[model samples]
Target chain A: MIVAFLCQNCAQGAANTAGVQRMRYSDEIHIVRVPCAGRAGAREILHAFNNGAEAVAVIGCCFGACHFSDANLITLRRVKIVKKFLVEMGYSTDCVTMYTSRAAEGDTIVGDFEDILERKYDPETPPCPGGAK
Target chain B: MVRLSVVQLRGCERCAWDLLTLAKNSSVEFVSHPLIDGGSGSDNDADFVVITGYARKSDEARLRELLSRGKKLILYGTCPYTGGIFGLMNQKGADVVPVTEYLSPVASVLGCAPSPDELLSVIEGQSAQRQPLCSECERHFTDEEFDKIIRVPDWSNREKCFNNLGLACSGVLSARCAQRCIDFDTPCRGCVGMVDDPPGRMIGYFGSLAVNLQVDTVATDCATDRLGDRPDEITRSLVDVVGTFFRFHLASHFKFPGRNPSTGDELADIMVARPIEEAPQIAATIYGRYGISVALNLIEAYEAAAGIQVSDETRELRSELRAAQDGLLTALDQHDIEALEGVIDKIRTIGGNEVLSNVYFGGFKRPVKSAKNGFDTYCVGPLEIKAVHARSEDGCSRVSFSTDEQGVIREWSCELRSA
Candidate 1:
């Protein structure tokens, strides 16, 4: 399953519009609401994986558009660091990412949800050990 | 009197040597200690027990039994506190079990080797609260230096904080020590256990930097540094995060194997065996593996098991620091004094001034001494050499000799007899 944490100001608004327009994203992806995408942080995101989530999405406001003053930038940097760790460990770096959305961009958030759900972890690669504890 | 018994399960006996000063303490009665000649038997019956070394899977049953004995258990040295250098092997799924998984220590002493004073203070019921070493650090640095992270700057003694100078100091993650390394102008390698939530803190710290670091930055920062890719090159130094941040806590910090380029190789050994160039750093942090040491590259391991194949100067001397291991191993193991000095000469020719004794002798523990006149006594178990000095009645002639236990000197000590 995929766990997506959506920021209330932007990404959540996009997700709500996607729902209003009846846009279909993967049923496996569950969205959690947060004040800012940075609040999802590495620990909370890793916690989702420990509980059987295959991938995690931290959908925040566009870089300069954060309601909480550069909160999305913090999330972006953390996701990059996490990806570096993942690739170094032989796991798929594509398993997690930070995406930015605008209130009117319903299709973009739904597309991100679908793209993340498609990046299945390969058993042939350094296995994830079923996500970090 | 506090009846104390000490057992060294699996560590460098440096910490045991650290306790030698306590031998003369009147209030503490040492029931058993390896260095204290009369010590023998398990340390089970003492009123207080001090155990050093990281416990192995085989040692778990014995450790639990000691814990069941109901005596106060004090963890002495960083090995028992956070698995020491061996803790790095846990990334390979090695069975380095932390005693905390089974029992909590009554009191804990921290340091790669705790000083005699710190150990004494803890033993006397002055348990220090756990705090990050940063709170006590007085050095200062600006955030701009992270752009060019240097290792051991010439000005490290400038009376500022190590991290403030972009020295890659892990003092922030570590618990406090005597600051011995810092005193000598060396960076704190973080041999002590980490403060709470070290990994989370590391993630935050590294994230905040947004450092666009690459291998060349090390050389760019300091061009005249050692040329060869010696194992102790930039990779082994504090320039990298694993050696800096997770130096002692990788076992508890990460939940994965250390394979990079994903060889998927599995051996009964705790560390994966690889050729010199592809050697693994402690974790997936790099391509290869080092054995039971923080810096023992696969070079010596391959040389010892197979014929000495480091004949290629290009490959062998890449990390010039390792230029002496196999030679020293052969000379010391066979008691060849000339060959040993020969290796020392080679290191000196490479401009290594002073006796460079950094080579890790694989399974052999290096001899260490702190006690006065302990030269021969302390080395007994590791490299048994006895030294004798003699002088003539006229004080005109003198001779000194050293050999393994079986050697005896008689005529060498005889006076010239007016001949």
Candidate 2:
């Protein structure tokens, strides 16, 4: 049940709002904030798995928006690249995913938590159980 | 005053300036002795002999003769320390076919021309031996002088392996100190000897370059000046650290970074900040519809038309384009570029009458105007056709075409031709 958070600028701020509101989230979800979806890379995603993360999600600004200008597009590209590496490394490729949100998307944040936690996760990855190989 | 002597044999004189700066307030002397004449008449009584430049057997013999007189010598510059530019001759199979094989090691080079400071340091009994600064665990002994808590080693090695560490001499003990080599913008040549074998903390000391500027030019410049192939080793070491990033950075500045264009600039440009607004998606859509080559072409076209070289502020954007290009190409290659035939046909059908040529090809030519003049040119020969690659949004298929005439290379639904 390893969990990780990929926070978009808005989503992250919303998470802070959630914290202020005392909204509940699992303690297992380790948050790693990125400037934009575009900054994520395959090496980083794999490094997460190598370092004992079982599930990872990328949160980005709303579909049409980004922080550094065109970062959403960069994020999509990185997601695709990371997905390709995930498939190649023979991990449950779906273990890594991406979502978009706005700073005010508190409801969307709750929905994302439900979706990620309920999704079927494979634990048979080579680096799973323990990172020892 | 500190007495100094300068000699030039086979080396760039930059070390001479460095040595002079170090000895500016001290008394100094200079000499010029080609590897011939047994290098006689040099002052034997001086506090130190600052040996600069290249040295051969003749210089080695003369230096040995000088040392026989019980005088101190300093092998100045990288030339004496690691054979400098002359190390190129040591490349394997580099010997002339007609001559006997000859390859000189760094030890041999230094044995020939000792630096002035090194000579003085050794002669003044300052270099008697490296005090055991570490215990058997290869850790330095350190404790708070203020508190003075007794923290002594519990174990000791009955056998001394410092000899087994393969260190050249105590003089190289300084190599263990975070190589100041980068201080001079030069990568450590390991002339201080191999780091891994020597179990010590002072050695393998990771230190940042004094100057924040990248040291890409150091590899090439030092190699060219040292007249040796040692620079190749330095470059190899750099690659291990930064991968293709170093080559691209240097090449971006020098106009010739490396052998592969796709891997070089294509991967290097992605380190920039990508704005999360509508830009990335719009960029993706534009990129998805037009393909990576088209995007790069547009970026290149925009830069060329603007007649301004990419500024540092916009470099990250360029890097993003490159990173995208690399990702798309790698994805396409894995899936086979031509598999996108159906998508290409569908895109073509969808855009029947629209301008499919989202990509534009500006004629490539030598520079007619510099960036200062607001006129820049992409070097394109009259006969060379620009290659175009197109791929679908899902990255499943891609196809490439090129016309003998001028045009931009990228993915698109429509065809373009020179006016």
Candidate 3:
């Protein structure tokens, strides 16, 4: 299952807009609202993985468009650090990703969710033993 | 009246003289050689002990004796604080000791030789905060002027910011140098020392300037040229990133990966094969030293450049690298010189020896040649190594090496020299 932490102002708004538009995204994907994407710490992301999150995504405001000054940049770095740590722990690094979106880009959010699912379960490489899933 | 005693360990007595001159001009009582009133005072009597220079073994007894006096110790110069120019001795396996190893100083006045005014201020119990050099600089460039910057400018006589002229000016990374070098149309070499900032913020500040000026190519070229020749983009990037960012503060900064232990060869091995368990400690150290903002900026830059995302096999390879380094460190600790070869071979298999040599051996065009006699030789920059010799001195081993060019030979050793 894919777990996404979305910023309330931009990413969550986009998800809400997608819902109103009746866009089709993977039902396996679940969304959690966060005050800002920067609020998602590495420990929380690791916790999601520990609790059976197959893939993790953090969506925030587009670069330079963050409502809070450079909060999205913080989100980017935190995600990267978690991804690196996950890789070191013998897990797939690509299972964790960061995305940026505008409130109006509902279609992009749906597409990104689908893409993460496909990439996480690529048939060429077998699932890592004792992987997050 | 507070008594101050200045002791010269091994560096030039310029700072001591400066302090004496300032004391003479002030109401403060300073005691040193050639006393104005023809009177000498014992160091034990002084309220504060200002020590200058890299502490050698001969100075150990004296230092111990002085420390026994129970007076407040102030490491008064760069040498005592950070080993100063003598820090280069670390590359040669010298045992130059900073005052911090003995005991924590009340204050550290860091400069090649701190100005008498700064010394006086420290003596007066004033805290010195490093301010950004840009705040003191008068030069300002418009967008158009910044856009015109190239790696090598045609006009050297132009009066403008050296950075705008494509020079590798470290003003952005440094504390104020009063624009002394920049005014003379020379690039700032960060001689005064780095401001207390993470290297990442400095990189971001420079990178943003490059992007805004549309001179990323120029900036990259300047960095590449400064780092000498290396073929791989990642290697070149690593060198460029470190060279540009950690120019002055390499010895002091925690994030650079080679500051602690001062073992270049082993550090190269450890950096290339960073252990999974050590990542948190490394991250914490970087964050603790440079703060959150700077740490984040650096992480972004490093991830973007290095493509840290790895596959399962690569992860295993990194683990092997970690084991190899741990073995090497263990061997060094146990004095098992014979086991180092095997450990180095394992590291080479995991992370190519060529990459290791290029990164730590100063980017030599050829592989490092082990001497038939005993010394290991490698080219460092433009200089060709003729020979290296290791000798024992006062319970410590000192490595001495010579570089030759056009029949002229110059020698350098880890041995501390007299002022």
Q: In CAPRI terms, where does candidate 3 land? A: incorrect
B252-287: candidate 1 lDDT, tens digit per residue: 555444544322332212233221211222211111
Taking the tens digit of each residue's C-alpha lDDT, what string does model 2 give over B1-419? 44434455543343443333233324443332322223454565455555565454445555555456554455554445444323322211111110001222222112211233454455444652322222212322222111111111111221322222211112223243222221211122232332222212111121111111111211111111001112222222221111111111111111111112221221111211111111111132223323343434433433343343544323333344344445434433343333333333332222110112221223211122212232233222122223323221222222222211123222223222211
Q: Choose the strongest candidate by TM-score.
A: 1
Better of 1 and 3 by lDDT: 1
**What DockQ results do all the predictions give, each relative to the true complex?**
0.21, 0.01, 0.04
Clashes of each: 12, 48, 0
lDDT of 3 by residue, B257-360 (tens): 12223334421211222321112122212121111122122222223233333233333343454455456545544535356557645644433341121211
Minimal lDDT window, size 10, model 3 chain B: B217-226
Fnat values, one per model, are: 0.20, 0.00, 0.00
Model 1, span A32-101: residue lDDT tens? 9998886877667656765677677788876568899876766665565555454434466666777777
Ranking by DockQ: 1, 3, 2
Model 3: lDDT to the true structure: 0.47
Off-target runs (Cα >4 Å) in candidate 1 are A1-5, A20-34, A40-57, A122-124, A131-133, B34-40, B129-132, B135-138, B143-145, B148-167, B184-186, B211-240, B259-419
* TM-scores of chain B, in order: 0.55, 0.29, 0.47
CA RMSD per model (angstroms): 15.1, 26.6, 18.5
| Better model by DockQ: candidate 1 vs candidate 2 | 1
Residues A42-77 of candidate 3 have per-residue lDDT tens digits of 545655765677777887776677888876665554
Give the best candidate by lDDT. Answer: 1
Error of 3 at B373 (Å): 52
